[model samples]
Target: MKVKAYITLKEGVLDPQGKAVEHALLSLGFQGVSGVRVGKYITFDIQVRSEAQARDQVEKMCQKLLANTTIESYQFEIIQS
Candidate 1:
């Protein structure tokens, strides 16, 4: 199975990286972008038989190390290939 994790800053959390990107975009004359938020994307392949097991393990991984649950939120979807 292939796992794709998207980790992002929680609402109300300050993100310097996103801020920098927003500023840069505005400076580049992209005024349509009112706000911007940045997040992380992680992709990996695992040999899991079922999506349920994968979801369980992935959630554990996220809590243990993959994501900072204190200030960040994460969502993942698995693709079988």
Candidate 2:
């Protein structure tokens, strides 16, 4: 099974990188762009026979390593490969 995880900063958290991108876009004449938030996408294969097992393992991975959990939130999807 393949798992794709999306990790993002929680609301009310300041994102310096996102702000920099937004400023650059404005400078490049991209108009009316606001509330830019940057995030992480990770994809990997997990050896699991069932979706439930995969989900469980992925959740643990995110909590333990992939995401900050305090300032970041995460979501994942399972893809059979």
Candidate 3:
């Protein structure tokens, strides 16, 4: 199975990188864009026979290593491959 994980900062957290991108876009004449938040996308393969097992492993991976859990939140999708 393949897993795709998205990790992002929680609400009310300041994202300097996102802010920088927003500012650069505004300066380049990109309009109507606001509240830009930057995040991480990870894709990898997991050896699992069932979706339930894959989900359980991925959740643990995120909690233990992939995400901060305090200032960051994560979501993942399992894709058969």
In angstroms, how far off is 5's CA in candidate 3? 0.3
Off by over 4 Å in 2: none
* Local accuracy of candidate 3 as per-residue lDDT tens digits, 1-81: 989999999999999999999999999999998999999999999998899999999999999999999999999999988
Candidate 1, residue 41: lDDT: 97
Q: What tens-digit string does per-residue lDDT give for candidate 2 at 3-60? A: 9999999999999999999999999999999989999999999998899999999999
Return the TM-score for candidate 1, rounded to 2 decimals.
Answer: 0.94
Q: What TM-score, computed on C-alpha atoms, does each candidate reach?
A: 0.94, 0.97, 0.96
lDDT of 1 by residue, 13-63 (tens): 999999899999999998888568999999999888899999999999999
| Model 2 score (lDDT) | 0.97
Backbone-clash count (model 3): 0
RMSD of each: 0.8, 0.6, 0.6
lDDT of 2 at 72: 100
Can you list the residue pairs that collide in candidate 2?
none
Candidate 1 least-lDDT 10 residues: 28-37
The TM-score, computed over Cα atoms with residue i paired to residue i, of candidate 2 is 0.97
